[model samples]
Target: MALDETTRQVNKRAVAALEAAVWGLREADVSVIKAVQPLEDLSNVTNAHDPALEELNALTVRIRAAREEVRRRWIAESEGER
Candidate 1:
Protein backbone atom coordinates (compact mmCIF):
# COMPACT_ATOMS: atom_id res chain seq x y z
CA MET A 1 0.00 0.00 0.00
CA ALA A 2 1.25 3.48 -0.79
CA LEU A 3 1.53 5.57 2.34
CA ASP A 4 0.34 9.15 2.35
CA GLU A 5 3.03 11.83 2.77
CA THR A 6 2.05 12.41 6.39
CA THR A 7 2.29 8.73 7.16
CA ARG A 8 5.68 8.50 5.49
CA GLN A 9 6.97 11.38 7.59
CA VAL A 10 5.70 9.73 10.73
CA ASN A 11 7.37 6.47 9.79
CA LYS A 12 10.66 8.28 9.33
CA ARG A 13 10.38 9.93 12.69
CA ALA A 14 9.50 6.64 14.37
CA VAL A 15 12.47 4.87 12.85
CA ALA A 16 14.78 7.61 14.08
CA ALA A 17 13.21 7.54 17.54
CA LEU A 18 13.54 3.78 17.80
CA GLU A 19 17.15 4.01 16.75
CA ALA A 20 17.74 6.65 19.38
CA ALA A 21 16.19 4.40 21.99
CA VAL A 22 18.51 1.57 20.97
CA TRP A 23 21.54 3.84 21.11
CA GLY A 24 20.47 5.16 24.48
CA LEU A 25 20.25 1.63 25.87
CA ARG A 26 23.71 0.81 24.57
CA GLU A 27 25.10 4.00 26.08
CA ALA A 28 23.56 3.12 29.41
CA ASP A 29 25.07 -0.35 29.27
CA VAL A 30 28.52 1.06 28.62
CA SER A 31 28.11 3.56 31.43
CA VAL A 32 27.29 0.77 33.84
CA ILE A 33 30.32 -1.21 32.81
CA LYS A 34 32.64 1.77 33.10
CA ALA A 35 31.20 2.70 36.49
CA VAL A 36 31.58 -0.84 37.82
CA GLN A 37 35.21 -1.05 36.75
CA PRO A 38 36.15 1.14 39.71
CA LEU A 39 34.66 -1.42 42.07
CA GLU A 40 36.88 -4.15 40.67
CA ASP A 41 39.85 -1.84 40.90
CA LEU A 42 39.15 -0.89 44.48
CA SER A 43 38.49 -4.48 45.47
CA ASN A 44 34.77 -3.84 46.13
CA VAL A 45 35.36 -0.66 48.14
CA THR A 46 37.90 -0.35 50.90
CA ASN A 47 35.22 0.73 53.34
CA ALA A 48 31.53 1.57 53.39
CA HIS A 49 32.27 5.26 52.82
CA ASP A 50 34.56 4.79 49.87
CA PRO A 51 35.13 7.54 47.30
CA ALA A 52 34.82 5.15 44.38
CA LEU A 53 31.46 4.03 45.70
CA GLU A 54 30.41 7.65 45.97
CA GLU A 55 31.53 8.32 42.40
CA LEU A 56 29.64 5.28 41.17
CA ASN A 57 26.48 6.52 42.86
CA ALA A 58 26.88 9.87 41.14
CA LEU A 59 27.41 8.21 37.77
CA THR A 60 24.27 6.13 38.29
CA VAL A 61 22.23 9.24 38.87
CA ARG A 62 23.65 10.93 35.77
CA ILE A 63 23.10 7.90 33.58
CA ARG A 64 19.56 7.46 34.84
CA ALA A 65 18.75 11.08 34.13
CA ALA A 66 20.08 10.89 30.58
CA ARG A 67 18.40 7.57 29.78
CA GLU A 68 15.06 8.73 31.11
CA GLU A 69 15.03 11.73 28.78
CA VAL A 70 15.88 9.52 25.80
CA ARG A 71 13.10 7.13 26.77
CA ARG A 72 10.57 9.93 27.13
CA ARG A 73 11.48 11.50 23.81
CA TRP A 74 11.37 8.14 22.02
CA ILE A 75 7.96 7.32 23.49
CA ALA A 76 6.62 10.70 22.53
CA GLU A 77 7.88 10.36 18.97
CA SER A 78 6.52 6.84 18.67
CA GLU A 79 3.13 8.09 19.81
CA GLY A 80 3.08 10.76 17.08
CA GLU A 81 3.95 13.58 19.43
CA ARG A 82 6.25 16.33 18.14
Candidate 2:
Protein backbone atom coordinates (compact mmCIF):
# COMPACT_ATOMS: atom_id res chain seq x y z
CA MET A 1 0.00 0.00 0.00
CA ALA A 2 1.14 3.53 -0.75
CA LEU A 3 1.77 5.50 2.43
CA ASP A 4 3.72 8.55 3.42
CA GLU A 5 6.89 8.00 5.40
CA THR A 6 5.21 8.70 8.73
CA THR A 7 2.39 6.27 8.03
CA ARG A 8 4.83 3.68 6.82
CA GLN A 9 6.92 3.97 9.96
CA VAL A 10 3.86 3.76 12.17
CA ASN A 11 2.68 0.67 10.35
CA LYS A 12 6.09 -0.91 10.61
CA ARG A 13 6.31 -0.38 14.35
CA ALA A 14 2.75 -1.60 14.90
CA VAL A 15 3.38 -4.78 12.97
CA ALA A 16 6.61 -5.32 14.83
CA ALA A 17 4.83 -4.96 18.15
CA LEU A 18 2.19 -7.40 16.98
CA GLU A 19 4.89 -9.85 16.07
CA ALA A 20 6.42 -9.35 19.47
CA ALA A 21 3.10 -10.13 21.08
CA VAL A 22 3.00 -13.43 19.29
CA TRP A 23 6.51 -14.26 20.37
CA GLY A 24 5.74 -13.17 23.88
CA LEU A 25 2.78 -15.50 24.00
CA ARG A 26 4.94 -18.38 22.96
CA GLU A 27 7.47 -17.50 25.58
CA ALA A 28 4.86 -16.63 28.20
CA ASP A 29 6.32 -13.17 28.62
CA VAL A 30 3.91 -10.90 30.44
CA SER A 31 5.90 -7.74 29.71
CA VAL A 32 5.88 -8.22 25.95
CA ILE A 33 2.16 -8.96 25.87
CA LYS A 34 1.53 -5.81 27.90
CA ALA A 35 3.73 -3.79 25.57
CA VAL A 36 1.40 -4.48 22.64
CA GLN A 37 -1.39 -2.45 24.25
CA PRO A 38 0.48 0.85 24.09
CA LEU A 39 1.74 0.10 20.63
CA GLU A 40 -1.85 -0.37 19.52
CA ASP A 41 -2.69 2.96 21.10
CA LEU A 42 0.19 4.64 19.30
CA SER A 43 -1.00 3.08 16.10
CA ASN A 44 -4.38 4.69 16.68
CA VAL A 45 -2.79 8.08 17.28
CA THR A 46 -0.67 7.85 14.17
CA ASN A 47 -3.76 8.08 12.03
CA ALA A 48 -5.60 10.69 14.10
CA HIS A 49 -6.21 14.18 12.46
CA ASP A 50 -6.90 15.39 8.91
CA PRO A 51 -9.50 13.94 6.55
CA ALA A 52 -6.86 12.58 4.23
CA LEU A 53 -5.28 10.84 7.17
CA GLU A 54 -8.51 8.94 7.69
CA GLU A 55 -7.64 6.54 4.94
CA LEU A 56 -4.20 5.95 6.38
CA ASN A 57 -5.69 5.65 9.85
CA ALA A 58 -8.21 3.16 8.60
CA LEU A 59 -5.42 1.15 7.06
CA THR A 60 -3.53 1.31 10.35
CA VAL A 61 -6.61 0.15 12.24
CA ARG A 62 -7.06 -2.79 9.90
CA ILE A 63 -3.42 -3.72 10.33
CA ARG A 64 -3.76 -3.50 14.09
CA ALA A 65 -6.85 -5.67 14.01
CA ALA A 66 -5.07 -8.25 11.95
CA ARG A 67 -2.26 -8.24 14.45
CA GLU A 68 -4.66 -8.71 17.33
CA GLU A 69 -6.37 -11.56 15.57
CA VAL A 70 -3.08 -13.28 14.97
CA ARG A 71 -2.05 -12.84 18.58
CA ARG A 72 -5.37 -14.22 19.78
CA ARG A 73 -5.09 -17.19 17.50
CA TRP A 74 -1.56 -17.80 18.63
CA ILE A 75 -2.67 -17.80 22.24
CA ALA A 76 -5.50 -20.16 21.46
CA GLU A 77 -3.21 -22.51 19.61
CA SER A 78 -0.79 -22.45 22.48
CA GLU A 79 -3.53 -23.39 24.86
CA GLY A 80 -4.67 -26.16 22.58
CA GLU A 81 -1.14 -27.51 22.43
CA ARG A 82 -0.98 -27.59 26.20
Candidate 3:
Protein backbone atom coordinates (compact mmCIF):
# COMPACT_ATOMS: atom_id res chain seq x y z
CA MET A 1 0.00 0.00 0.00
CA ALA A 2 1.01 3.58 -0.48
CA LEU A 3 2.25 5.45 2.59
CA ASP A 4 -0.78 7.73 2.63
CA GLU A 5 -3.15 4.80 2.44
CA THR A 6 -1.31 3.11 5.28
CA THR A 7 -1.51 6.27 7.34
CA ARG A 8 -5.20 6.55 6.68
CA GLN A 9 -5.77 2.95 7.75
CA VAL A 10 -3.88 3.54 10.95
CA ASN A 11 -5.82 6.70 11.66
CA LYS A 12 -9.06 4.88 11.02
CA ARG A 13 -8.13 2.21 13.51
CA ALA A 14 -7.12 4.79 16.05
CA VAL A 15 -10.35 6.65 15.62
CA ALA A 16 -12.32 3.44 15.93
CA ALA A 17 -10.54 2.64 19.17
CA LEU A 18 -11.18 6.09 20.52
CA GLU A 19 -14.86 5.89 19.57
CA ALA A 20 -15.21 2.51 21.23
CA ALA A 21 -13.65 3.74 24.43
CA VAL A 22 -15.67 6.91 24.62
CA TRP A 23 -18.91 5.13 23.84
CA GLY A 24 -18.18 2.37 26.32
CA LEU A 25 -17.58 4.87 29.07
CA ARG A 26 -20.80 6.61 28.22
CA GLU A 27 -22.69 3.32 28.29
CA ALA A 28 -21.26 2.54 31.69
CA ASP A 29 -22.40 5.90 32.91
CA VAL A 30 -25.88 5.13 31.70
CA SER A 31 -25.84 1.84 33.53
CA VAL A 32 -24.75 3.55 36.72
CA ILE A 33 -27.48 6.11 36.41
CA LYS A 34 -30.05 3.41 35.90
CA ALA A 35 -28.78 1.55 38.95
CA VAL A 36 -28.93 4.61 41.15
CA GLN A 37 -32.23 5.95 39.89
CA PRO A 38 -34.19 3.78 42.26
CA LEU A 39 -32.17 4.99 45.17
CA GLU A 40 -32.72 8.58 44.14
CA ASP A 41 -36.44 7.98 43.83
CA LEU A 42 -36.51 6.53 47.33
CA SER A 43 -34.66 9.54 48.64
CA ASN A 44 -37.26 11.78 47.08
CA VAL A 45 -40.01 9.85 48.78
CA THR A 46 -38.29 10.19 52.14
CA ASN A 47 -37.19 13.76 51.57
CA ALA A 48 -33.58 12.74 52.09
CA HIS A 49 -30.48 12.33 50.02
CA ASP A 50 -27.72 9.80 50.00
CA PRO A 51 -24.23 11.23 49.94
CA ALA A 52 -22.89 8.41 47.80
CA LEU A 53 -25.63 8.84 45.27
CA GLU A 54 -25.05 12.58 45.28
CA GLU A 55 -21.40 12.02 44.56
CA LEU A 56 -22.23 9.56 41.84
CA ASN A 57 -24.54 12.12 40.24
CA ALA A 58 -21.74 14.66 40.37
CA LEU A 59 -19.38 12.16 38.84
CA THR A 60 -21.92 11.59 36.07
CA VAL A 61 -21.78 15.28 35.27
CA ARG A 62 -18.02 15.15 35.10
CA ILE A 63 -18.10 12.09 32.89
CA ARG A 64 -20.58 13.77 30.55
CA ALA A 65 -18.28 16.78 30.34
CA ALA A 66 -15.36 14.55 29.54
CA ARG A 67 -17.37 12.83 26.83
CA GLU A 68 -18.22 16.18 25.30
CA GLU A 69 -14.55 17.11 25.31
CA VAL A 70 -13.69 13.85 23.69
CA ARG A 71 -16.35 14.41 21.06
CA ARG A 72 -14.99 17.86 20.28
CA ARG A 73 -11.46 16.56 20.02
CA TRP A 74 -12.59 13.72 17.83
CA ILE A 75 -14.29 16.08 15.45
CA ALA A 76 -11.28 18.38 15.34
CA GLU A 77 -8.91 15.53 14.73
CA SER A 78 -11.14 14.07 12.04
CA GLU A 79 -11.10 17.43 10.35
CA GLY A 80 -7.29 17.28 10.22
CA GLU A 81 -6.77 19.89 12.89
CA ARG A 82 -3.95 17.90 14.48
Per-residue lDDT of model 2, residues 1-82, tens digit only: 5567777576566667656876654454344445555655666777443444444455556656666777875565444431
Better of 1 and 3 by TM-score: 3
Itemize residue pairs with steric clashes in candidate 3: none
Candidate 3 residue lDDT tens string, 1-82? 6999998887787777768768987897898789778878888677565876887888888888888877777776676676
Backbone clash pairs in model 2 (N, Cα, C under 3 Å; residues 3+ apart or in different chains), count: 0
Off by over 4 Å in 1: 1-18, 21-23, 26-45
Q: What lDDT does the true structure give each of the candidates?
A: 0.72, 0.58, 0.79
Position 14, candidate 1: lDDT: 80
What's the lDDT for residue 65 in model 1? 75
lDDT of 1: 0.72
Worst 10 residues of 1 by lDDT: 43-52
Q: Which sequence of candidate numbers ranks them by TM-score, best first?
A: 3, 1, 2
Candidate with maximal lDDT: 3
Number of colliding residue pairs in model 1: 0
